[model samples]
Target chain A: MQYGFFQVLRQVELAPEHFVIWGRLTPPPHQPILPGSFLHLKVDPPGDYRMLWRPYSFLDYQPDTHQAAIYYRVVGEGTGQLCQRREGELLPAIYPLGTPFTHEGVSRAIMVAGGVGVAPLLMLYDRMRHSSPQLRVEFLFGARSGRDLVPGLLEEFGVVARMASEDGTLGHRGYITDLLPEVLEQGEWQMVYACGPNPMLSALADLLPEGLPCQVSLELPMACAIGVCNGCNLPLRSDGGRYPRRLCVEGPVMDLREVDFAALV
Target chain B: MGGSSAAQTAEGFSLEVSLGPLRLSSPLIGASGCVAFGEEYRRLYENSRQAMEGSSIAQLGAIVTKAVSLKPRGGNPPPRVAETPAGLLNSIGLQNPGLDHFLAELAPRLSQLGTKVIVNLVGDTAQEFAELASILSQKTDFPAFELDLSCPNVEEGGRSFAMSLPSLREVISRVRQVTDRFLIAKLAPNVCDIGEFAQAAVEAGADALTVANTWIGMVVDVERRTSRIGRTTGGVSGPAIRPLTMALVHRVRQAVRVPILASGGAVRTQDVLEYLIVGASAVQIGTGLWIDPMCPLKINRGLREYLARHRMSLGELIGSFQAEVSRGG
Candidate 1:
């Protein structure tokens, strides 16, 4: 983990209330920036809003040049304030936090994302593409409506893309689950990765083929993004045993089957 | 950030604290639950700029592990924590990996950390408490045991043992027989007289006392028309309960001779200094640590400045607060 102030090179409005914050972060020497990891942005809310810094996922990172970016949505006062910052501002951050998504010797993988949840998966795809260019990959991106979809980052990724929107303005006219079944039927995917709001992740977890392996990035209201807080707990179950796992260290990305979806709101 | 600082004071005063056989480099501890036994925060410390600044987790006096038990507890169901004004209501329910898993997996790494380890133990019965103590007594690495008496006394119809004199004595006495290590009985603050509970545990051979645990609190999400926590009520911690706990520390100081390890709402160095003034030999940082992993380091830095500014030693401040100040004419 690295704690330092990174200069904001640019901030792009991905969609309504959504943004991709680009920071000039060059890690120390020989440090590997992994996928599904996050950085805590200490956005000092101007007034008495009661929130400290907040956590956002690494949208994409370049190892050679050592540049990193974070994706965020204006959910509350904390994040809403962060989106208002201009470029060239120094943003304090704690980086490469939580566990990363690993390729686990799979020849093929499927990714399911909802809105800003697509952030980490993009980085995962970006990094994995280097090692396994021929590795078959499919991306299922979803949003509330047409205006909310990120413009063209998907087309530039150069992979099979499947899109969905609830308002029916985008690719498939329904929830992401509407497209998941057909995507599952398309190939013998070795692994599945998902990230999004709680209900969406839960629905995807429930919709997956039982025997297939899947990983999910869990989100909980947080304070200190570090493991010390014990605040963000995702109750999990595997092999009939149920327990709570802190998202900070154990995972932000966890096995989909292990998550006890019913345990969280 | 500074060339001149309190942590750099060169004088006769020292921040070190000694309570029975356990010695602490400073009075602040990484309260259980907020900090993992030690390893996780150690990584955070290592990653932090404080490492280059010449500060580390080693500066903390000790660490109390989250409540461990004889059997593994999965913890409370959904919504284990709820945020209140400058505090939180938590119902973690002492979730742990059980004795065998802890000793085999986490204990080895925890002992290796260059800080004192005070294992917090919780059980349903006095015998259960003693069994944990007996088991831990054999572990040479751990220097102390903190009895989490906030748990329900199943032997006495579900009221917390810390709330009843007899139950408190029975549990403390039973654990005392098995462990020669420093025994700290953590009492609760909700009862009518916290001092009475403090005295009872000491009489039963408690080496020290953790002044009080979280206060009983309930927060309702009125719009949703439901309890905030999955458990209807949970323990309230942070600045909300600091004053109430400070008073309890003062009362416990007057009632007993054992050192008091103050818990509950402590977020700042002033809170720690105040607790020491009210007779706490040490202070534990819980909800605050959850808010920031670097709290102990920040507080210690502030404490060194405080000691230097006042030109006083920590021992001079212990129980030094004069509640009834005389007005000079």
Candidate 2:
């Protein structure tokens, strides 16, 4: 974990209420941010002294330039303040937090994303592409509409994703689950990586092929990503334990089978 | 002010405070549940290189651990917290890894850290509270224990022990008999006449009193027609409760002869000073850490600068509130 001022380098509007922010770390992280790790950015101003910290997974990170990008969909007051920030302004943040994805022995994997949930999975794919040249990686991304699709980022990643949108403006019409059966048949997949809305992730948990290992990045609301405030709890299966695990520390990435989807309320 | 002592540094400034029998190097304390056995903050400090100027845990007077119960509690279900206007509402329900786990796994690491660690205890009955205190006192050489009297008493029809004077007296006196170590009674803020409770706590053998715990509050999700937190109501803490708690500290001070450890909303150095001026022996930073983990460091530095600028000792600043009388009333 590292805390420093990150100056805004650029901000791109991916869609209405969706954005990609690039910031330069004043004091670069001690270690490169690993795939599935996130930065806890304080969106509220410094003068106010009332901290409003939000955790955002890395969309992309540059170790040399000390530059990092994060994708956010404006949802509340914290994200609202983040969107209005401009270039050259610095954001106070704690970096490389939470447990990252563990893809040690994997040779083939499919990355499934819903909306801006594509952020962390992109990082994991980048890691796999660099570390294991022989790895076969594919992406199945879905959004609400064509405007919500991040074509620029996908192009930058050099990924031609099998896409889906609810309104039929993109690749496949309806939910990503509609295309999952076909995608599962196409690849002799060793593992699955998914990130998206809880409802979508919950559905994916039920739909995945049995015995297929999967890691999911959760989107639970959190305060003090350091694990003190027991706010962001990930409910686990009854057999796992009676207590819920803290998503900030225990996960933002967890085994799909371990989470209790029905008990998430 | 039984053990309160101040040693002036070469710069002629001091941050030391005494809470009855206990003494500390600095006046700032990490409240219960905020530091959580000190491991998380220790990891952060080690990773961040202790970045902020003097924000090390070593600089704090003490840290109150999360509530330790007789059995491990699962806590509330999902959505344990909600952000309000400058405050946070939480229903964590005192989730802790029971006494045996705490003493074996968590307690050992606490002594390794330079700061003083105060265990926060919660139980269903007065005897249960005593049992926890007795075991901890024998097992660990920790400086003190803070009683979390806000828990509902099963023996007394589920009413909070802190709400009724008899229940409050029974719990404190029971624990007081079992241990000679310093004891702090944490008062619940929801009751009427908070000052009266403070007096009852002190009379029942509490060495000091943590002015109050989080205020009871609720936040509704209008769209879903349900509570934002897992529980119907949650404890509220942060800047929104700072003013309210500071007043509680003053009121408690008025009614008690023992030291007062102020706990509620203390995010800034100014907030700490306000609590001290209103008669707090020391200030505990709770949700303030969520805002800035280095707050203890920042507040410590800020306090030093403020004291140096004023050329006053910490003892002089505490309970220094001056009232402006209005004759018309």
lDDT of 1 by residue, B1-329 (tens): 33422234455457888978887888888787777678776766666654345346675788899888998877666677777776777776777778888888988888787678889998888999999989878864588889999742122375788888998999999999887888999998878888788888989999999978888888998988889877778888887888888889988998999999998777677788899888899999877665444567767777877877888888887888888899999
Docking class of 1: acceptable
Candidate models: Cα lDDT each = 0.78, 0.83
Q: Measured with DockQ on alpha carbons, how good is candidate 1?
A: 0.33
Tens-digit lDDT track of model 1 for A1-265: 7555557788887667877778776334134778888877657532222334577888778776668877777877667778877787766566778898988576689998888888888888877788886778888888888666676566545655688899999789988878888888999899998898788888987788788988898787665677655567777776243354678778899998778878776
**lDDT (10s digit) by residue, model 2, range B151-170:** 42122475689999999999
Model 1 Cα shift for residue A210 (angstroms): 4.8
User: For model 1, what is the error of residue A48's alpha carbon versus the real structure, in angstroms, after optimal superposition?
Assistant: 9.3
Clash pairs, candidate 1, are none
Q: lDDT at A68 for candidate 2?
A: 93
DockQ: which candidate is best?
2
Specify the highest-lDDT model's number.
2
Give the TM-score comparing model 2 with the true structure, all chains together: 0.95
TM-score of chain A of each: 0.91, 0.94
Worst 10 residues of 2 chain B by lDDT: B1-10
- Model 1 chain B: which ten-residue window has the lowest total lDDT? B1-10
